[model samples]
Target: MTARVPHPPIEPPGTRVRFPDPVLAPSHGVLAMGCDFTPGTLLRAYRSGIFPWPHGDEEDEGGSPLVLWFSPEPRCIFPLEQEPHWSRSLRRTLRIHPYEVTVDQDFAGVMHMCGETRKDATWIIPELERGYRELHRLGWAHSVEVWDTSTGERELVGGIYGVAVGGAFAGESMFHTRTDTSKIAFATLVTKLRAAGYVLFDVQVENPHLASLGCVEIPRREYLGRLDDALEVTPGPLL
Candidate 1:
């Protein structure tokens, strides 16, 4: 049996549209459900401190999988100051590899690789990819890539991609085909954001992998407060 997500974002009465209010998002984190994942809706959701992720199965009574939106009560983020602590092995890997890191060279490649390289099931569906691709074209989304060209063909070993609004970077997903490649890409992104005066690197949720990268979680209210501050600066020269 599929365990329904608790306190899923409530739909408003008599309205076909859904807007997730950060101030009213439930403690369970989901803020809205069943909206189309278009560029406009996604951008609006991101600005409102909510993000969309759909259910893995098609169980909706209406025959469409719910496009569940979320704003976790304890939002995960990596403040620019608490930089990722690189382990000795990771440092060595970085030092030895001639990784060429670049920005926005191939956002779609990064996104596709991120989806294809996942070890388990992923929610980066085709709809999400298409929406993000459009966002990239509009300049609100960007990617950092770690390239390896020693094999005579241009190959992307690792990368990370996300949406940027003002001083906030909503990290979407990352993947690495080579050791420490994703780490290198992620570290580069954080450094660039810091230099560009960004304050928030929204990671969405915490896990052991991110914990190693110095990410932490703060309450939803606190995240919203900080989100306001992050919105003050412009995210530019996205390296």
Candidate 2:
């Protein structure tokens, strides 16, 4: 038997990478599986309108769980032209201005908190965590941290984290330890993205919480078209 040869690493920050057409993906939305999480690979995947959504503990060659690349039909995204829906209570929380919002301050802390605070999911495995951490170090991943400043000491109460490419941002997960803190963090992130001229805000999938914040689902084809346009833009750095 011939020995298996490793593939070359993906290159460049904004290079386009081809992926299986999402239209041909199965009902479960997995476009591919079992790839390493190098920064170039993640950037290539995102640039191709795909993202990893690994589940289970089955280790791959990198001691990480087998990764699943997904490009779901009816992809959920936040429209860059409008503000997120704000509830009366959330408006009140914003008016009070009780928390300090910072960007890229504590990405790993936010990620770990998000994993720990997920309602009924165990998707943020250790291997994925390391991958995103590396992305953060390389300026492709970012976190919006919400801090409780009422007690004179800054305490992290909530945050949101995600990957960025060109004018697009893909929000991975968010968590809150205090009331409306995560919402505050998300709103802060959106504000920053908009100010920086981001054209797309891909939230991956919609949940009740995301829908409440005004995310909308569009056909994968439309999403791909928009993603293509987004990648052509050169927005200011999100961090």
Candidate 3:
């Protein structure tokens, strides 16, 4: 059975809270009030469309108090009902490459690779990695992987990972190694999500690639309204 998540009381606008440690709570939803950034605390935040991204030293034993909770305004969402716009060049590349797509396979590897390849400082620190891995074990988080079969070796070429609640998929991060690989993975995932009867694919933020894929921004108020509808329906596991 899935764990029960409780909706916490809303925090006042413009109020900042410093979260330094993770909170381990059985409730799989947001804590009403806390300054902890523990595994359970992050888990609860994601379930409520809030994510803790802290910036600080990688090896600092004391850890960092510089943190921010993000719930993006004008959230990006893909229109899965519309036909996915695969460019002719992309289609040609697909024909030549013929990559295979897998879901929920090598999620930890994907997360690790994402962290390892970080050129800049990363908020997905060691603790965050362990936390998400635990969430993956609990089936609250998942990854979509793209594979190159010709090499007979698989690397996490491109994919997206995020939390699922009811019929909503809150996209966290997506990375790609090959051209259009991430786009392919995203398009395919959107197709699968549509088949599963999901109503929201919260891309969280927008960029050129996501915009090209038909992701649009809506006001935060409108997004929460949509979230309400999305949480009412049941959808299948992302895997």
Return the top candidate by TM-score: 2
lDDT rank order: 2, 1, 3
Best by lDDT: 2
lDDT tens digits by residue: candidate 1, 1-239: 11121121222223235685877777778777774766667766777788888666543568776578888888999978665577787677767778788888889999999989985536777777888887777677788889999988779999999987778889999999988888998888988888877889999989899989778899998988888888777655664
The backbone clash count of each candidate, in order, is 0, 0, 5
Q: What's the residue-level lDDT of 55 in candidate 3? A: 60
In the range 99-131, model 3's lDDT, one tens digit per residue, is 888777777766766666556437667766776
lDDT of candidate model 1 versus the reference: 0.79
Off by over 4 Å in 3: 1-40, 56-62, 91-96, 118-121
Error of 1 at 94 (Å): 3.4
Comparison by TM-score, 1 against 2, better one: 2
Model 2, CA-based lDDT: 0.82
The Cα local distance difference test for each model comes to 0.79, 0.82, 0.64
Segments of candidate 2 deviating more than 4 angstroms: 1-18, 59-64, 119-121
lDDT by residue for model 2 (1-239), tens:
11121112223354344668777886567998765677777888888788988776666777757778998888999888886677888788888877788888888899999988886447787878888887777677888889988899888899999988878999999999998899999888898999989999999888899999889999988998999999887777654
In model 3, pairs of residues that clash are: 21-37, 21-38, 22-37, 22-38, 23-38
Per-residue lDDT value at 57 in model 2: 61
TM-score of 2: 0.87
